[model samples]
Target: MHTPASMVTGIVFAPLGLVLVFTAAITPQWREGQARLGASGPGSPLRSGAKGQGKGGARPASAGALLLLRSDGLWESCLQVENSELKQCWPVAGSYRRDPRVRLAQGFILTSLFLCGTGIMLACIGVRCWTDTPLRGVAATGGLLVVIAGLLSLTALSVYTHNLPRLGMADPSKAIKSARFPRLSLHPAGSLYFGWLGSCLQMLGGSALLFSFKRPAYPDCPSCLKLRVCPACRPCPEIPNRPDNDVYEVSC
Candidate 1:
């Protein structure tokens, strides 16, 4: 007895969650930060004499430009130098492989995505409208998978968020060894928000699906159990009897 509301919700949200999770996983905007390059304005060394200066010189500006940096679930990082328009991407050195937290987060996120996909498939097959006889057990199992997927996603997100400070901190040894790389400060980007939203949707859809389980209405007669056939509309069978003469009578 799946209600129309629950069926619609599960159908809509499960797919929506899948799309959002996939989008979040692929996009590299999970964490973003910018580095300032040089000083700006009339008093700055980059800016020369008042020849180019004007009356509105009071508007101070940075002599150096900002460079954008972003990282994704895969630990692939991108750097946009001069401005955020130009992009160059690369792996995050050996940190992704060597860091335990990174490995755990990666595994959890990947697992969550897999579970979400599996749950969606199962739910599709078990949905009432798709089948003549809806399998309540199958739909419940799918809902369980979706719930687990949501939990895994939340765990992965939590782990990454908790370790963000450490991730952004520059290695003291490397900083002391070379002045080329400076410490970076990273902030949550659009993808992180998308992941959160996706996780919530998964949970909601799963719960709705689980609650949709109920016994289907029974037909009036066992003979009319066939799909789209009603007991009242079915014609009765004919009976044959003979005493002195053979005779047959049809009963409807």
Candidate 2:
């Protein structure tokens, strides 16, 4: 939500997005079924890992599923089923779902960065208005909002991190990995908390700054110092792709 610090936020977050996308794209592209355990070739039932130790052939319950069992302290993968006529090898687990916190964190970082970056672009306009004319009535609130929101984000993140010791598991938070079974980890939880906090600040700050961009700035005319007048027309047309000042007024 922090929109003011676009450049700073954008630079920091873009790399994270790229890293996640690359990891997603390259996740074990090879099919599990075709990959043999312990480099076994065709017709060889035995798998290399400790996971496939015992319970060969198949169980009567499942029709066409690989049965994993341990026997005599060894692991084995069951290739064929004993009962049903169906002939199929055991399937390797591959289901992966999106985590909401991760998604939110990603969005928050990216958005805040964008907002911050935009602030840089509009800096010139703000300066121009200050010099050329009097500040508009509406302009003051937006700038204040951006500063306040950014502070709020920092506060939220700090609170979340402070509370982490209460909610985290016994395992080392740093050891959590992409291949974890439960998927959720204290690392990510912490990251999400801080990430959202920063982003919200950025969103609010950036929004406030964005609002200030269009607000009319008035300055005393050079010749007529006594009478105050709006500065040269607001540079709305110059600013690229800013959000609307409000819901009802659609102007960017």
Highest-lDDT candidate: 1
lDDT of 2 by residue, 1-252 (tens): 112343234233333433332232223211112111221333324332222333454334432223322110001112332342434333222111132322332344344344344443343334333343423223333344344434443443444345433322333455444321223222222234334544454454444444444543355444434434432333222223357531121221
lDDT of each: 0.64, 0.33
Per-model TM-score, in order, reads 0.70, 0.27
User: In candidate 2, which residue ranges exceed 4 Å CA deviation?
Assistant: 1-98, 129-131, 134-252
* Poorest 10 consecutive residues by lDDT, candidate 1: 231-240
Local accuracy of candidate 1 as per-residue lDDT tens digits, 1-252? 333466568768877887887787777777776645333443433233222332334322433433335454546777754422346787666644466776777788889889888987887777766434466667767877888988898887788778765763345465433223344677788888888899899889888778757543433333332323222233322222234543322111
Off by over 4 Å in 1: 1-3, 39-72, 82-85, 128-130, 168-171, 176-180, 216-252
Instruction: Give the top-scoring candidate (TM-score).
Output: 1
Model 2 TM-score (2 dp):
0.27
